[model samples]
Target: MTDLLWPGDARAGDLFTDASVVEAMVRVESAWLAAGGHPSELSTAFSVRDVAVAAEGGGNPVIPFLELLRSRNPEVAEHLHTGLTSQDVLDTALVLQLRDTAAFVARNLDRQVAALARLAERHRGTRMAARTLTQHAIPTTFGLKAANWLHGVLDARDALSAAADLPIQIGGAAGSLAAPTALAGSPAAALERVAATAGILGLPARPPWHTARAPFTRIGDAFVTCTDAWGKIANDVLLSSRPEVGELSEAPAEGRGGSSAMPNKHNPVLAVLIRRAALAAPPLGATMHAAAAGAIDERPDGSWHVEWATLRTLARRTAVAADQTAELLEGLRVDIERMAATLTAARPGIDAERRKMGDDGPYLGASDELIDAALARAQGKPC
Candidate 1:
């Protein structure tokens, strides 16, 4: 089936292209060759299509990729993947791809946080009915609502950044440096090669983590958290944009958000898609968690194979969701008059509460202070 659901226009769209993945794999291979003090020059004259058919024979792409490399570079072919295995090359390449992806997602997240901060500051005093259990319970400002989103996005961004800063994977056949030591003349020299590979890829230098899957699990969780934060905003948007509520609406764009059957419908398309991503991400993350749980022995049997597509799907969906969230916040429309009208309509409940307890000032206790604290945190000041 065609991927009609996710639209790709920016940096996030191109990071995981087949060609980019192949390039990353080739780069990893070259880094390994150079780290081993071998002739690293090899042919980059093959495409993913060239290796796709032959990949099934070995259950991974690296085997066929090595064949193509050998065919193209007869002189350096013998030393192409000297002490490396398929998992090493593929995992390191995946890290390289995620390095780029994390940068892209972080930029979009910064935009989203900035947009939300502005909204929170601008709407600090716009009174709206605060609902509990789908019913109006008290008065609150839209600023406070936006501040809640801002807090979530800020935490999500930090979590993603820390999780994406993962170490490069460089284990030989089995999470042991035996082959690398044999090739490099000493165990210390073998570790140096791993460090060199880390330097080349701009990832952290750490011991082999072929079977230690916590890093991948943490990264998956971070992606899910991103969708979790954005999904909450989308949920609120879906509810607030209702015709009956009419307190918020997505800003109109040309040739966008029109219903197929209804001519007068302006659908909440961005929020809908973000919510779709939110729903889709947790299961993918769970797959990684399950794989991690089942990862046994020197390497996993079938569990290791499950991570490739699962991580790619989760990362792609998250990148798209981050962009959608930023766009949603950038063009979000808040109806101040409607918020005031809704608050006015909820006055009967407010009056009933006031009769029970003595009349208080608007029942918006500490909302302004909470908004101030959120803004302070956004500005790097102590809240």
Candidate 2:
């Protein structure tokens, strides 16, 4: 079966490669080639296409490529990557991918947030009994749940915005852009220009981070931020849809999930899928963190590489999860009758307790007050 996610899109594949990274490497190499002058010029002296092809196979091809560059044109090789190292290219590429992914996530989040806000307004006074640990807790307007979900999504959005400013690694051989510095005015200036290029491409600038993997770690955290909120909504849907609870359920639909023996089962398939993806996100975040920790100065000791697959998998999967969550929220089926029934069943106990205390029972005390305060604040009214 064809993969529901990713499929075979060029842009998706390019998230890991594409021309941006290649062009950056080429520009660095060309500068070195020009330093040699005319016949000794490095541009005509090396083949990036050849190097790229060799790098494609992975295991230690970079060393051989450098060897070839040095043998054929020693002067050009002298300036080739300059003080830069492979981690520079790889890390920068990862940041670029993250920046692009962040953009996509941001747009989708905006849409989902708007949709949820509308839902909240529509259900502002729709009363329901809130539950804690699967037991009746207190009365709450369904709008409050929507508002809580919105707050979480907004938090994730803020996290992504912050992560977008993380710096890209570009220090050469030993966490210093020394060689490029020697050829192109100053190493610091070269790094600045590299950072400018990265920023232009939507990545943040940072000091040389050859061994430091904090940037990637931050990006991983942002991804988790989004996934966690999405997971909460999914978990709520699953819990609310229980036959015993039945206050909410997936929109009635055909072909969601089925039982072969019992023809009456309509499963919350999307909710289940989203929950599964949410469960997968924390481990993926940990994998990225471990990879970042494993990076050595100017080189990765396979720790960074270890996270490559997991990061990519998580990125693609989370995108799918986000899309699914949005759809689920947009089309959710809330049963007013069921909500009333559940609340009615719990009202007697609540009323008895309230009578016993006279004024201090489980009356959702400040909840309604808080909601009224929020509404008043939104309307520019006095608190």
Candidate 3:
């Protein structure tokens, strides 16, 4: 899973990767063994590449992975994958991977929200021109704009939190706990095993969700929501950083925003990349929803298979976008002088119109109050 096109893959840390997915799947298998009162430590003899190559025979990595594990760890051969199907192993592993990814995304979004809060507080009265339909409409403050962005990101954070609080998938063959219950001697014991396994992985325990695709859909939608908020900020930055507008600009780094052919260009590359992710998110979300809708049987033929890579890609893009947004906000260079100048240039006509409508000054009604309210809301913890 090396891709030059995806900004997420180019970053330093491996948030989501082929190797990480294998590691998560291994964790799920280990947890299952531990819950069954067996030694949980499994062998690490197989490489990710080996499992992937072997997965061609089966539809997923779990089958081949278990084969390799069973061959290497003969002690746990009977217990490994005793009550779980491929869906159980893969879905639970995905949840674990999403759990870690959610934490990382939440941290970056927190950084973005904190930075926006600072901007809102600092520039509470820094007036600027408000645009409507891409035209100068009225007077507004930079604080209000930043506050607006903050509100959107906060909403996205909450959505991601709700989606991240997902339960572990432990349904046996055909979405039933039959095998586990028969093995445990009772359904209650089987559920206890599930709860115990979930506890080990720091996830909630729930009944079989093999057919219910809402959790995966929700994760996809959350990723879209996050990127939507980030895209709003990037769009604003892109428009305002135009040479003609000169209202905002990314703080310069040594190798950032340079052009290959043009010598005098300092393009807004960060926003461009964030916007790119934003544009791609909605389609991925739609794909998840489509998969959910087309999920027909206890285990879908192709729809369930469709989810693994789509969700992984969505997570990667969303996580990378969060990091980009945090960096964008951290080094955001707000040109208060340019904003004031733009406001001064555009306010007179609107002021005259307002005066004729019995207003004495620019009607910046509730701008300050709304910013305060947004900042107050931002005080709440990130999900």
TM-score of each: 0.96, 0.77, 0.97
Q: Largest lDDT belongs to which candidate?
A: 3
| Residue range 258-312, candidate 2, lDDT tens digits | 8788888888877888788778889989998878767765667778667656766
Candidate 1 per-residue lDDT over residues 100-147, each given as its tens digit:
878888999999989999999999999999888998887889999999
Better of 1 and 3 by lDDT: 3
Identify the runs in model 1 with alpha carbons over 4 angstroms from their true place.
7-11, 39-41
Give the clash count for model 2: 5
Q: In angstroms, give how far residue 225 of model 2 lies from its true place.
A: 1.8
- Pairs with backbone N, CA or C atoms under 3 Å apart (clashes), candidate 2: 33-42, 83-172, 83-173, 84-172, 181-187
lDDT by residue (tens digit), candidate 3, 169-275: 99999888999999999999999999999998889888888889888889889889999999999999999999999999998988888888998999998999999
Enumerate residue pairs that collide in model 3: none
What is the C-alpha local distance difference test score of candidate 1?
A: 0.86
Candidate 1: Cα lDDT at 302: 76
* Model 3 RMSD, rounded to 1 decimal: 1.9
